[model samples]
Target: MPRIRSSPNSSLPNPNAPPITTTTISTTTIHTNTTVDPAAAAVAGFFNNLLNKIPLPRWAIYTIFACGALLILLICLCICKKCCCKGKKKKRQKKTDEKINLNGVNGKTTTALVQPDVTDVDYGATKEKQRGKFLYSLEYKAAQSELIVGIKQANSLKAMDLGGTSDPYVKVYILPDKSRTCETKVFRNTLNPVFNEQFTFQISKSSLLNSTAVMQVFDFNRFSKHNIIGELRLQLCDVDWNHVIEEWQDLAGPAKFEEENLGEICFSLRYVPTAGKLTVVILEAKNMKSMDIGGSSDPYVKVQLALDKRKWKKRKTSIKKKTLNPYYNESFTFDVSFEQIQRVNLVISVWDHDAMTRNDAMGKIFLGCDASGNQLRHWADMLSNPRRPVAQWHNLLSAEQVNSTLTLKKKIPLASKLPF
Candidate 1:
């Protein structure tokens, strides 16, 4: 039994065990008419050759390709998201701006330099809105009790000069007390002027309701009086003090700007304390009212010294006939002691000389220690610099306006009031 042992690798059948019956298992593979793409095959072959050339394992190659494909897909998605967000943000901002311009917070359209919708413009309103618009800012500071005003710029102003442009400036006044005033520098030959100027008004919270701000745009003239282009009056009671108020407002026609055109005069003053002498040189006068027919005047200046609100001494300059702007360049001296200078007031009255009738008072101005505004300042300047001449330009006022401002002792007789 040990002599004949069958090996596992032997091809002959082993007879040691009982007779074995083998059963055959059959399998069927169905053949369909599916077509193979040559392009796909070439691509697959190219990738296969590329992957085979790499030293890494097959698993690492497959992981790298999968990671690369996922990274590219994520980048594309991020770009698309950013573009969509930017477009949406722009549209939203545009819509918000339009809404603000159309319907402002306080029911008034606070349209700035941006034009409002055509439907929002009221056709029944005055046509002065088409004249121009100005930009400004107002801020109320509660801590300091101040109203800070900023005059930014103006656009499309009317031209008053012969040229097709305008020399413009801005005047800011706090009314009904117009003592507080600020003026901007004149910009020459421009329809649109930028006045980056600021002014401060000392206003308490209690007075805010009663306060009003007047901003006047004026056309500057070298030879004639300045003409008011337009104006904007804003009442402080209508403002919201929670934040700054900044807007572009349409300019309206000035109602009472004619009073501002009373005209201006330029003169120099010199006071010598040791000599007790005060000299006044009438340099020039411009924009005087035309008192005579044919729109001209025979103008002359009457300078008088007033002590205790009564006329003490007076002098006159030769009349410049038929001239609105007269150049006098004449100097007059007065015996004014240092003690008397404090109470003395210099009265300048411009008169139109007439042969047939009484002289007409064109305008008048007074300068003294008790004078208000520019008059007081000018008098102080002359006193501060003794013996040195100080020159200034003063705005003239009507006779009634002058009388209302001065604290006069009594009315002068008509004989002494003559300009001859």
Candidate 2:
């Protein structure tokens, strides 16, 4: 029999030698044998050889392997935890970025129509904030630097100044340029003043969205300062500039809008350049001053056009009775050449018609550059560019003489100081 010895698989490898395998066998003719998986056996053998080479005891070596496995597990857990935290941080950063995009200080823009046109209010589309009728039209001419506004008229209004009458006039301007655009003529003691007047503004279309139309109504006063009865402010952006929109609007007043507006007016104008004629249509006046002892006074529009220096041609609308605001729809024409258009002056005076006494001058206005700066501008625009109709509301002069009163008022007080 050949002498045989088995070496353990736990022994370290020799240089330039093949792999080792070990087994225990009992030769009793009833042999017992066992085999392990190649891959599993190789892994176990590698650990076993590594442990056998260590100088530590078997128990100590086993302890070191167990601790090393535990340490590896702890490191994996730490790395996984760090990865999870990093993922959450990334999610938080994404959310923060979205929040900044949705809301910012410089991101807000005005979209709602601030104050809209007031017309025959439907009462259906109205909110609690919608008080009056809103009706107006705006045309934006970007190249011309102009804004054209057409205001027809207002219906029912509250009387503020007098017992049952208000000398209502409309003054409009684009805010941030509060120099004052133009004002409608006062209807006299009547609540309603017909101003079928068209107004124009020299404004760039680009600035309209940021600009607003500020309108205020005032009662005309010859002796006292005009009192602000109410106001109507409108935003340009809200208007549908494409189509002409008309609706009834309630006029809002400054804090103390005590009562209803007095009334409104209607008037139109035409300029025939070739014919050398300037025609003014005095539609109507309502709620006028009562020159009578008890009842409402007869009211009419006294129309005058300055033909030459120290000469003013006069025309009159039919007298209306009882009611404060009278309607005349009467058209008056004056001889005006293209050259004379600038030189001639149009003066409109509202008078109280009295059967017994002389007609009392209620209110008069010089419609031109000399008085209403816009009048001359309007005249120039019409003559230079004729044929097209141009209309606007002109504020009536508080003084009977629109041209002279301003300088006279200034000089009347200064006379005492002028070398006395």
Candidate 3:
């Protein structure tokens, strides 16, 4: 016989109390000697039921924890993104305000301001002003025989017609190198004109030769004693002199000489120390008949002496037409003060007024005194004529003559030295 115990929570037999099974039921006997602890069984039964109700795997619990962490990180990132966007928006707004303030202070309008193009104004007036300190904007154009440069103010401000005080002057600077700055004045105007003015600069070949090699312009007012004005650069290049001459050849054609062989002319001077008179003997090789000097109405030769290599002392001598033979001769006597002159250089150039040309008949001669006046050294070129003839003429003086006259053996001593 088996005995069973019951729990108070449910009507179930406790296993710890006893075991009951129906094996054979023919003859059965009941025995009640076993005891069971109900309190412990109830607790154990509660735990077993809880475990069965909540059946969770180890991997599922770990997955839930990881998911919770990811959700928390996502929430933090969203908050940071919002904060950064707000900050950037505030900074951009501040910059915009600053830009607006700057524009307002400068008196700048929202509308587009029409600026003046400086290329429209006259370059002549501007060029003159550029020689001074005034800043100028210039545009240049080169033609067949003319060069034009235009200039105007760089700013678009209406020319103010301020009275005498606002006398505007244009200055131009001729800058050859880093060391030299030559300035020239171009134009002056008291009243401001509505339209830009144009000035013309006319330069012949001779004038162009005297002009500066390079030119620049600047504003004079801007170049105060305390400050220097900005410089505008200009370049002059490719000067064709032959083309210029050809353009003006019609006006100058009649003056050209027609001589085939222009004879050579040479001279020797002897200074008399005792009398203070210089004796000059003229030398000519060919007959004056062949030299057709363009119908010379004023056919004369002028002899000039340079005292200090600076200013010339002049002497005039007339050449008689057809009076002398192929070999001509003339003499001249002049008084020179030795004290006033350190040395005298003689230059004899031939002039034909009708032909409008001057030919260098001979080179320079230096005159000084020795005792006898016979020891005067004549530094004359031995060539038959001037080596560099202007027209189609050849020199007749031989090399030996040039060398012999240039040496000391042919020098003549002066009888007496002049006072000054």
Candidate 4:
């Protein structure tokens, strides 16, 4: 009986279940499950398939990487080649422009033989056509002292005085203490005169060292009885030879420069008027390497003196590499006396085997004497001292006794006042 009663509600709603409400309730629950886009899914599937199914050999991977690197290198090389080619083209254009510019300029051309022997050049040419008409003055000062002289012009006419007379040549005189003297010119011009032509004097360092001992200028052709036309006085201070030697030592390092198996270098001393005696020394540096000759043969040193713009003396000596050190310490000496000399020029050279090939060093010195017997010399040291006194002339005297019966004209002073 009980089993029959419970079966009554199996197919139908029970009447006691709170009126058996038939309302339907709808509910939606959101669960956050990661959703993949179609594109992303496809990419993932592609990678999975590749990693899982496609088995690439190590050698194949290496080969592919190497090929990619080679391709990149080829691209870089191509870029470099293009850049280099462009650069070369630009350089060629620049060269062409320079050549055009050079062609447009007025220039004189000189051809010289390679490594030719040292030769002297005369300032005065016998022919008037070869003579130029330029004059130069050089001054130096040191420690409140001054040295002044006329610089000789190359290939030029001799300097002239105010009256158009040729001036005396200037010379440099050096003392044993390394002090110097400046020379004076006899002819006086109204300060600087205008010349029709131009000239240049060449001086180098080696020659300068030798002649720095003394320097002077003089006027050889005096229209008036007075011999001195212009005088330059130089005082030199702070010319530390020790410092120069120290600098040379620093430059040369510990290397010893000495000539081996070579005979003593010789020099001839000569006298110039209005200039004093000069002692010259010549020494050669040896034991040099082949490269020291500047990659050429026929290396040599030259020495010279210049008088005015028209006179010069030259001296030279051959260099032996086997006897030269990498450092140069060779030197030369000459005893030159100046009876009335004015200007002195010194030049040195290193010769190359090729025709007309030479490297040179030069210098100048000046000397002068005043009525007070004060001597003046000029060189680089003069630039520091400028207070030195120049030479002055005294009143001319009559050699003969004046007769009481005859009245004589008073002698006029001819020379200009000395410039201190």
Compare the candidates by lDDT and give the number of the best one. 1
- Model 4 misplaced stretches (Cα beyond 4 Å): 1-277, 286-298, 322-342, 353-420
Better of 1 and 4 by TM-score: 1
TM-score of structure candidate 3: 0.23
Q: Is candidate 1 or candidate 4 better by lDDT?
A: 1
Taking all chains together, each candidate's TM-score versus the true structure is 0.45, 0.36, 0.23, 0.20
Q: What would the per-residue lDDT of candidate 2 be over residues 287-362, giving only the tens digit for each residue? A: 4545677767667787876633334467888878766767677878787777767666666778777777787766
Q: What is the C-alpha lDDT of each candidate?
A: 0.83, 0.63, 0.39, 0.36
Count clashing pairs, candidate 3: 52
Q: Backbone clashes per model, in order?
A: 0, 55, 52, 116
lDDT of 1: 0.83
Best by TM-score: 1
lDDT of 1 by residue, 1-420 (tens): 124333455677788966655545556668899899999999999999998999999999889989999999999999999999999999999999999766665544455336766654665244786568999999999999989999999999988888888888887877665545556767889989988888887788988889889998988664445678999989999999899988999998886643456567888999999999999999998888888888999999999888878777899999999999999999999999998898899989899999999999998889887665456667887999999999877777766556655656664457666332
lDDT of 3 by residue, 1-420 (tens): 454544355478676865654444354768889787999899999976865666677577668879999999999999999999999999999999999777657554533245433453455446434323322333323453343333334322123233432323222323232221212332234222121333334444444444443322222231121112223333444344433211100001111222123344545555545566655556443322233435323334556655534334566565545332323356666675545334555545444333345532322223332101111222222112222211112122222322233333323234374223
| Least well predicted 10-residue stretch by lDDT in candidate 4 | 245-254
Question: RMSD to the native, candidate 2?
Answer: 26.4
**TM-score-based ranking:** 1, 2, 3, 4
